[model samples]
Target: MDLPAPDRLAEVLRQRFGLDAFRPGQQAAIEALFAHRRLLCIQPTGYGKSLLYQLPATLLPGLTLVISPLLALVRDQVGQLGARFDIPAASINSDQDDDENARAMAGATEGRVKILFVSPERLDNLEAWRFLLGLPIDLVVVDEAHCISTWGHDFRPSYRQIVRAVRTLAERRPSVRVLGLTATANARTEADIARQLAPDEATPLRVMRAAMDRPNLSLATVEAAGAPAKLAWLERFVAQSPGNGVLYCATRDQTAIVAGYLAQRGLEVAAYHAGLDPAAKRRLQREFLDGRWRAIAATNALGMGIDKSDLRFIVHVDVPGSITAYYQEVGRAGRDGLPARGVLLYDPADRRIQTHFIRSAQPTPEDFERVLAVIAPDADGAWPNLTRIRVRSGLHPTRVTVVLAELREQGHVEKVLIDRKQVYRRVQGTDTPLDLTRYTRQDAVRRAELDAMIRYAEGAVPCLMQALRRALGDDDAPACGRCDRCAPPAWADLPPVEANEGVAGWLLHRDVEIAGSRRPPMSAGLALLDGQLRAPPFIDFMRRRTQPGASLAPAVIDLLRRQLDALARRHTFEAVLPLPSRTWAQRDAVAALAAEHLGVPWGADALAWRDAPDARQGELLNNDQRRQNVRGRMGAALPGATEGALLLLDDYVGSGATLAEAARAVRVAGHGGDVVPLTIAKVRWRLGARGIV
Candidate 1:
C-alpha cells in the first residue's frame, strides 16, 4: 500500500489546504496514512496531529473516520479541516441533536463528508457499528490515543473499546488503515497504547515520534504556605506577568476561588470548568481566546481542544496526578515557538487531594453487585435491558455502562438485543464471580505515580524539565536549562501562610421556607443528587433506614442529631410531628429519636401516606415526575397553635410533594402558626413556580 504519488499528495496540500509543506514528522505520518499503515504517532502538541489524516483524506476516495475523546476536540478539528480544505466535515457526539447526527451520517453515506468525527464511546452501540460498516471508511484515526492505555494518566475505558470498532471495520474494509495520535506518551504508555489500538492487525505497526523537548517553555514550582497566601501569590504572579495565560486547577471550586481572587484585584479573569453548561464553557473559552479576559482559571477540561499558538503561560494551582497529564497541560503554552512559563504552586497538603481523586475513581465490588442486582431476568430467563433497568436502579447511566463492561469482561454476563435495545444478563450456568482485583492493582500504580508527581512539584531534581522527562521514562530527555530550576525567578520567596488561610467552615444556619403553601417548612440532607438510584452508602442507607430490622450508620445518626439540634436552636421548636413512613416501622427515622433527645414531645403518626404508588422516588428523572411520585400521598394531623414553630419531620424529603400536601392537610385541619419541616436527608424537591429542584 502506497500513497498517491508525491506530486499528487503535495498538490492537494498546496491547492486545497493553502499549505505546501508538512512539519517535521507530519509528512511521514501523511504518507503512512495513505499507505494504510498501522501507525502510532506520538507527536508533541502543536505539531499538527490533526493535519496528518486531514491531508490524506483529500487524496483518498472514501471517508476518514476519527474517534475523538472530547466534543471540543472534534469541533475544533472539524472546523480547521473545513476551513482549510473547504470540504464537507461533520461530527456526531452525545451533545448533538438527532437530526444533526443523522445529517452527519447521511453525509458520510453519500460520500460528501471526507472526514467524520465520532465519540469513542459510540463503539458501545452495535447499531451504530453496523451502520458505519456500510460506509466506505478507508482510514480510522483514534485521536488522543493515550486514553486507550489504562496505565496512561488520562485513561478512558471508552477509548479502549474503539479498538474493537476499528478491528470490526478493518474486517469489512481490509485496507482501512488505523492511526492513533497523542501528544503525551512515555515508553511504557506508548507500548500499551500501540498494543490496544490495533491488537488484531496482521501488519506490524510503525510509530512516529517527534522530540519530547520544547525549548521555549520554562517550569517553576512555588511553595505557598496555605490557601490565602496561595491566593495572594496567584494575584501577584499574574500582576507581574506579561501576556494572557490559563491557571490550571484540579477542581472547579478551586478555579472559582482563584478566579475570584484575581478578579477582586481588578484583573480581567473568568472561571472555566466542565460542570458548566456547554454554552457557558463555549462562551468563556471564546472570551479568553478573544483577549477579553487576562486569564481563565480552569480544570484539566480546558487542556485538550484549545489550540492557542501564543499562550504565554500555563500555571497550576494544585499538582496533577501524573507526569504525562502534567506535560499535556503545559504543552498548550509556547506553541508559537516563543518562550512560555508553566508554574506550579503547592502546599505539601495538596497531595492529599490528588490521592483522594485517584482513590475515588476505582469502583468497589459493592457498586458492581448493587447495579447488577437491579436488572431482573425477563420471561424465558433473558437479561433485562439497561434503559428500563436505569429507572429501577438509581445509578448514573455511565456508571451502569462501566459496571456492565466490567461484568462482561469477567465472563459473568453477556449482552443481547431485545427488540433492538441492548440488554444484559448473567452468562448461563458459568456462575463466574465478578473480579475487582484489577482495580486494586491499578490503584496501587496510580498512587506511586502520584508520589512521582509530588516529587516533581517538590523539585527533587535540579532541573524541572529533566525531572519530568525522567519521570515519564524519557531516558534521553535533556535538561532544558531554561526553567526556574536552572535560574530562580526574581520573587522566589512567597509570603508566609496567613493565620486564617482557609475559608471559614459553613454552618447549618438556614431555614427552609415553602411559599404559597400551608406545609411546614423543611430541612433535608446535606446535598441534593439527580433523582436517580445510586449505590450504597446512598441507596444502601436509604433501604436500611426505611426498612424494618436494619441498623443505621453511626455517622448518619450523628448528622441527623446535629441538624435537629441546630434547627431546634434556630427556631426553638416545642413539639415534633414525624411524617408517617409508608410502613409503621421505619427503623432508620431519626426524627422521633432526635426530638426525644431534645426533650420535645413527638408523635410518629402526625403525617400519613394516603395510598402512594409502589415505585420508589429514585425512579423519577426530574421534578415533575418526582411531584407525581408522592402527590396526595400524605395527610397531616392538626395541633393547637403555639408561639414557637411546629416541626414536621421525615427521614428523607423528596420533591416536597408529601410535605406540601401534608401542610395542606394540617391547614385544612385548622392548625395555625409557622409549620417547620425537617428531614434527615433532603432529596430532590421542586418548589412551585420555580425550577429549583
Candidate 2:
C-alpha cells in the first residue's frame, strides 16, 4: 500500500488550508494513515497533531470520527477547522443544545460533515453508535489517546468505553482506519492502546514516536526551606521572569489562593479550575490568551485544550504526582521554539497532601463489588434499562454509568441507551442470578492496580523516569535526562549528614510524644518546633537518651507534649492528617509546644547540611546548622549578605519559625543582606480561617 509523498500532502495542505508545508512529523503520520493501518503518532506540543487527522479528513471520502477527551478541545478544533474549510465539522457533547445535537446527527447521517468531534461519553449512547454505524467513517481518530490507558497519569473511566465503541464500529465497518493521536505517550500508554484496539494475537501493533525532547525549555528545581520560603521564592521568580506564565497548584483552593496572593502583589492574574463555571473559565482563558492578564494560577484543569504558544514560564508550587503529568503541564511552555523556564518548588511535607489526594479517589474492592451488585443482580437475566437501573441500584448516576461500562468490557453484560441514559442488560440471557463472586474478584484486581499506583507515587527512588519505565515493564531502560534527579543543578550536590546528627532525634521524640500523649497528632505549630529543635542539642540529647545506660526524664517529654498541645489549640501552627489516622494529631501537639519555647537563630551551617546529598542526610541537620551554612556561603559570595537581609525559600509554612531562623542567620553573617524568608505557598493554619480544606 504505497502512500502519498510529503510533496503531495504538502500540496493538499496548501491548496485546502493555505499552509506552506507540513509541520515536523505531520507528513510521516499522514503517509502512515494513507496505508490503511492503525497509526499511533506521538509528537511534542505545537507539532500540529490535528493536521495528521485533518488533512486525511479532507482527502479520505466519507466522515472522519475524531474522539476527544475534552469538550473544550473538540470545540476548539471544530471552530478552527470550520473557519477555513467549507466542510462541516460539529462537536457532539453534553453541553450542546438539543437542536444543535439533532443537526449534528443529521449531518453525520447525510455524510455532510467531514469531521465529527465527540467525547468518549457520547459513545455510551447506543443510538449514537447505531447512527455512526449508518455513516461511512473513513478514519476514526482518538485524540489525547493516552487517556484510554489505565497506566496513563490522567486516566478517565469514560475513556475505557472507547474500545467498546471501536469494536462495535469495526463489526459494522471492517475497513475503517483507526488513528490514535497524542502529544505524550510513554511505553505503557502505547501498549495499553494497542491491547485495547488491536487484540488479535497474530496482528501485533507498532507504536511510532516523534522526538520527546524540546531544546528551548530550561528546567530547574529548588529545595524549599519551608512554606514561607517557597512562596517568597515564587514571588521573586515571577517578578523576575516574563509575564506570560502559569503557576500550577495541586488543589482548587490553592489555585485561588495563589492567584489572589499574586494579584495582591500587583501582578495581573486569574485562577482557573473545574470548580469554576464554564463561562468564567472561558473568560479567564481568553483574557490570559489575549494578554489582558499576565499570569494564571490553575489546577490540572487548565491546560488540556489551551493553545497559547507564547507562554514564557511554568511554575509548579507543588510537585506533580508523576513525571508524565509534570512533563505535559510544563510542555505548555516553550512551544514556540522560544526560550522558556519550567520551575518546580518542592517540599517533603507536600507528599502528605498528594497521598491524601490519591487515597480519596481510590475505590476499594468493597466499593466496586457494591456497585456491581447494584448494576447486575442477575447476570443471566435481561439487564434493566439505565433509568430503572439508576433508580433500583440506589447508587449515584455517575457510578452506575461507570459500573455498567466495566460489565460491558468484561463481556458479562451489554449496554444500550433508552432516552439518553445507559442501560445494562445481561449478555447470557439465562434466568440465573449473576455470580457476585466474579465481580468481587475483579474488584480485587482493580484494588491492586490502585495500590501499585500509590506505591509508584511514594517510591523513594530518585529517578522518576526510571520508575515510569519499570511501571511500563522496561526495568533496564536508561534514565530520561530531562527529569529533576538526572539533571539536578550543581546546588543540589551538598554533602551528606548523619541521621543522628541533626533534627532526627527531635522529630522522633515529637513523633513518640504525639503517639503516646496527644489524642490526635501534634498540630502544625508543634511540628514547627519539633523541626526547629531537630537542628540542635535536642537531637544530641535524644541520641544520648537512647544509649543503654542513659536515663531520660519523663517530665521533659511531658512538658514538650503539653507545649505542643497548647500551640495546636491556639492555632499557631497548621497540621494535616489523612482520615483513618490519629497518630498525626498527637504528633501535632508535641510539635506545637516545641515551636513555642524553642526560639533561637538557625545557623547557616544547618541550612547547608540539611540540603545534603541524600534526603535522609539532610533531614538529620539542625536548623542552626542549615542557617549557618547559608550565611557562610552567601556572606562569601554577596558583599551585603547579612542575617536580617538574606532571603530564604521554602514550599510551605505551618509555623513561621523556619523562615524566621533563615532570616536570623543572614543578620548574623556580618553582611547587610536582609534575611527575608518567603514561602512559595502557604495553607491556612487555623481550620476556620479560610480555605482550610
Candidate 3:
C-alpha cells in the first residue's frame, strides 16, 4: 500500500474540507485503512470520524462504500460531504424511488460517485448484493458498527452480514479496506465487532478506542414513580430548558403520550419513532435540526450520527436497555461543549416494559417451525427462493432470516447454493425436534443486562455516570461531580398524576391508523379493530350467519349495531351503504338493521355486487390475491344517485376488499357523503391490550 505524501494529505484535507488537522484518533484510523488493515475506531460522538474515511474517499481510487444504519444518517452524510467537500456522493435507500436508486447505482458503477451510502439491509438483499459485487470497492466503512454484535445494545441481525459483504468485495478489490466506526461500545462489543469484521486468513482487526467521558453533561436521576410522573417531570424540563432538546421514550406510545402532554402545554413538540411515516420523520428531523421545534419526543430511533450540537438537555422517560444505550443517548447533549443536563425519571415499574421486549426479541421453537412449515422442496427435493418461503410464512425478511440462521446452527436445516441463490432445505436423515433451551439462556443474558440497567438507574452508592464508565471498560474514571449521586440533584419535586393502566374506553370513540392494509389502494384511516375475527365467538358467528338458512340472533345484532353506532357517532354519517354481499345474496339485513338503529337511512341500491363466482375474501392470502378478487366486483347501481353522509357497513370484514370496492363505488358515483367504514369483526394481526395497537 503506497501512502499519500504528508504535504499532499494536508493539501487535500485543508483544500477539500477546509480543515487543518485530524481529531485524536482519526488520522490513525485513516492511515490504518490506507495500509489495507481492517480498522475498528470507537471514538466519541462529534469526533469528526467521518473525515477519517471521507477525506481518504476523495483521495483514493474507485468507490469508497459506506454502510449506514438509518436513512437519516445516509442523507445527512451524503448531503454534508457533497456540499461542503465537493465530493460526488450518492446513496441508495428505501426513501428514494426505484429510478432514483438506479441512478445512484449507475453513478457508483461508472466511478463518477466517489462515495456511496447504502443500507446495511442491502448486504443480505440478493439484488443489492449483485449490484455492489460489480463495483470495485476500495474501502468499506460500517457506521454504527456496534449493531453488528448480538451483544451490542442496538443489535440488528441485518448488520452481522456486513463482513460477509466485505469478504465478497475483496474478490473484486483484492485489498479492499474495511473500517468499523461507532461512538459507544464496551470492550466486549468492540472485540465482537472486530472479530465479525475481520476476514478469514487475514490479520486481526486493530481496535482504536478513545475516552468515553463527556464532562459537559451533568447527569441526574429523578424518581418519578410511574408514567404520569415521568410526563410531569418532562413538562418542567421542556418549559424551563433554553435551547432545543430531546425527550427519549422507551416506546412509540410513550413518545406520543409525552409529546402530546408537552404540546398541550403550549410547546412546539413532535414525536419521532419507527411507526411514523417516512415523510413525517423526515419533516420532524429537519424541523428539529433547523431549530424550528422546541423539543422532539422520540423513541431510540431519533439520534444517531445526527449532528445536533446545541442540545440543552436529554431526558429519558424510562430506563434504557443498557449502559451503552444510556451513554450513547446522553452523549447527544452538549456536543457544543456547553453545559447541559442528562436526566432520567426513574421508575421501577418501567422494567416490565423492557423485560417484555427482551423476552419477545428471542424467537421460540414455535417461531422456527412456523417458518419451516412454509418451506417447499422442488421436484428434485430442493427448496424454492427465499422470497417464496417468506411470502408463505408471512414474516418479515429479517425475522425469517434470523430463524433460518438459528435452524442452520441447530443442524436442522441446510442452505445449499442452487443456481447461485441460497435455498434452504431441511437436513436429510435428521430428527429436528423443536428445542428452545438455547433461547432461554439467551433470555437470561438479556435479563442480566436489564437488571444492570436498573441498578444504574437506582443509583445505589455509585454515581450513575461512573457506573456507565466502568461498565464500558473505563478504569480510574474519577467522579466528575456532575451527577445526582455525586452532587445535590435538581428538580426533586414534580407534580404527580395517577398512572393509568389498561385501555381507555374512550379509545373506541377514536379512529387510529391502518396505513398498509393487505387490501391495497384504500385511503388509510379507521377505528382500531377491538378484536380479531378469528376470536372464538366471532369465528363461530361467521360460520353460522353465512349458512343458507341462518338469521343473526337479536343479541348479536344489537352488539354489532352499538359498534357501528359508536363509529358513526365519531364520523357523523347521515346514511348507511351496506356493502355488496356474497353469502347472503341481496339480503344485507343485519346492515340495514344497524343503520335503522343509528337513525341513518340505508342505501340498498347505492352499490350492488357484480354477478361473479363466489369467493370468500377471508380465505385469500396476500394483498395481490385479495385485490384481484375484489377488482371491479362492485359498482354504483344504474339510475340511482349515491349521495349523502354515508357509512359503509358490512357483515364482517377480513381483507377489507369488499368495503374498499364499495367505497370506490361510492366515490365513483360522486357521493357527497362522508364515507366511514364500519364492520362487525375485522381480521387483525398482533392485537394488543390497547385496541388501537
Candidate 4:
C-alpha cells in the first residue's frame, strides 16, 4: 500500500469532501492507514475523524468496512456519504427490510460499494460474519472504538468481537489495516482499547491524539438545591439564551419533564430518547438541525454522530456517570470555533441517578440462571422467543439482554436467525461456568469514575476545562481562562433563580398514565422515576404510607385528591373500590378519600382475597409467578349487575399483574362497565424489598 501523493490528496479533499486542507492530524492518521499500520485516534467530538477513513477509501483499492455501535449513526452516516460526498456507500442493519439488506449485500459483492457500514451486533450473525469475511476488505474502522474496552464509559459487549473479525481478514490479506476512533478515553481507557485492537501481541497500535483544549468554550458549574431549583434555573437560562441548544437529562422521564416544562413556558422544545418511534426521532432531529426548534431535551442517545456545528449551548440537568461522559456531551458545543457555553446545574442528589444506573447494570449470578432456564429449546433444538423468556423470567428486558450477551460471549450459548428473527441455542455439551470477576472489577471502576465526576463537579481543581482535559489524558492542557473558576462569571455567586410558582408546583406534582393489563385499559399515578433513580421523598412516601397499618400521609392524600379532581374533569365514575391488599387501613383511608371526593358510594369489601399467600407481589420475579399467585384467589362481591365506570385504587402499580387479576374478578362478578385504575405511583421496574421506585 503506497501513500497518495500530497497533491493528489489535496485534490480529492477539495473536490470530494468540499474542504481546502486537512485538519491537524487527519493526514497523519490517513498516512498510518495507508502504510497498513494499526492506529488509534483520540480527538474531540467535532474533529473530522470520519475523513481519515472516508478519504482513504476513495484512493484505496478495496472496501472500507465501518463497524459502528449505533444504528442511528450508521444510518445517518451512510445517507451522508452518498448524498453529500457522492461516495458509493451502503449499510446493513436490523432496521432495514430484507430487500434493503439484500441490495446492500449484493452491491458490496458487485464492487459497486466502496464503503460499507454495519453495526457491531451484525457480526454475531453467522451469515453476516461470513459475508464480511469474504469481502475484499482493505481498511477496517471501529467508530467509538472505546466501547471495545470495559474501562470505557460506554462499553458494548459486541465490540469485543471485532478483533476476531479483523484477525480473520488479515490472515487472508496481510494489507488489511485497522483504525479505532473515540472522543472520550482517559489514559487507562486508551491503553485498554489499544491492547484490544492490536492485530497481534508484538505489534503496538500507533496512538495519535491531538491537544483537547477548546479555548472558545466556557465551562461553569452552578449549584441548585433540587429538581425544582434546577428546573427554575434551566427555564431562565434557556429562555434568555440566544441560539439553538440541547438540554441533557439522566433519564427518559426527566427528558419529558424538562422538555414539557420549557415548552409550556413558550420554548420550542421536544424530548428525544430511545423510546421514541423512528419517525418521530427523525422528524425531531431534522427540525432541530434546521433550527425550527430552540432545543432538544434528550438522554445520551443523542450524543454520537450528531454533526451540527453551530450549537450555542449544552446544559446538563443532572450529573453524568463519569467525567468522560460529561466531557463528551459538553464537547457538542463550540464546534464552529465560536464562543459557546456549557453549564451544569449540579445538586448533590443528582448523583443518585448515576448510582442507580451503575447498580442496575450489574446483574447477580442468580439472575443469569433464571434467564437461562427460560430459554429452553424446542423439538428442533431451537430456543424460544426472547419476549417469552422475558415474561417467564420476570426480569427487566435490559437485564435479559445483558445476560444473553454475556452468555454468548463466553461461548455457553450461540445465536442464529430462524425465519429472519434471532434465536439462541445452547452450545452442545459446553457447561461454561459463570465468571463474575469481571463484573466486580467493572463495578469498582465505575464507582471510582463516579466519585471523580462528583469531585470535578464540586471544584476539585482551579480550572474546569483544564481538569476535564487532564482527566481525558491531556496532561499538558492549559487553563482556558474563560471558565467560571479561571475568570469567574458575574452571576457565579448569584442567588438561586426563582421559579414560577405554578411551574414549580407542576414539576413536583405531574401525573402519569400507567399501562394496565386488562379491563381498565389505563391507570393513573403521581410522577415517579420508572426505575431506582427516585427522590428520597418518593421512596419515603411509598415505604411509610403503604405499610401494613399506615395511612396515606396528609400531603399524599392532598396530592391524590387533586389528581382525582383532574381525572373527574375527564370521565365520570359511579363508585370507588379499593383493590384488595393486606394493608387494610391504608386501603380504607384511600377508599374514604376517593368516595368523598367523587361523592359516590364506597364499594367496601367489593374485592376480597380468597386464599392467596401473604407474599408481596413485588417479591415475585416474573409475570408468570405474579399472575399465578393472584389468579382465582380474589373474589369480587359487587352489587349484582353493577354498571358505570369504577375507580380501582391501589398504593402502587409495578407489573399490573395483580390489577389484571382484580379486573378479571370484577368482570366475572357481572360488572359491565369500565374499571379505571388510580394509584399513588407507577413503577417502571419491580421494586425490591428495600429499593426505591
Q: What would the per-residue lDDT of candidate 4 be over residues 1-693, giving only the tens digit for each residue?
A: 788888898999999999998988888888877775689999998888889899989988899999986665566678789999999999997757688899999999999999999988888777899899889998999988888889999876677678778778889988888999999998998999889878778988889888788778888888786667877788778888879888999988788888878888788988888766556667787778789889889887774555677888999988999988889889988788898889888889888879888877777798788877777876787676666566567775556777788887888777777887777777778776888787888889899999989988888778899989998999988887888888876436434556456765765566655544334344333333222336454676666764666766666677788878877776678888888777544778778878998999988789888887546776766555566668778888887876677788877777677777778888888888777778776675443222225
The 10-residue segment of model 4 with minimum total lDDT is: 524-533
| lDDT-better candidate, 1 vs 3 | 3
Q: Is candidate 2 or candidate 3 better by lDDT?
A: 3
Clashes of each: 12, 83, 1, 1
Q: Give lDDT per model, in order.
A: 0.70, 0.58, 0.71, 0.79
Off by over 4 Å in 1: 199-202, 365-367, 378-401, 416-420, 431-437, 489-693
Candidate 2: list runs displaced more than 4 Å: 84-87, 225-231, 376-402, 411-414, 418-693
The local lDDT score (0 to 100) that residue 690 gets in candidate 2 is 19
Query: Which candidate ranks first by lDDT, i.e. highest?
Result: 4
Question: What would the per-residue lDDT of candidate 1 be over residues 291-403, giving only the tens digit for each residue?
Answer: 88888898877765676678888888888888778888888888888988888887898897787666546667766877678666766766667665554454444555667
Per-candidate TM-scores read 0.72, 0.61, 0.77, 0.79
- lDDT string for model 3 (329-352, tens) is 888899888988888878888897
In Å, residue 283's CA in model 1 sits off its true spot by 2.6
Question: Comparing candidate 1 with candidate 3, which one achieves the higher TM-score?
Answer: 3
Better of 3 and 4 by TM-score: 4
Model 1 / residue 244 / CA error / Å:
2.5
Clashing pairs in 3: 644-673
- The TM-score obtained by model 3 is 0.77
Using TM-score as the yardstick, the better of models 2 and 3 is 3
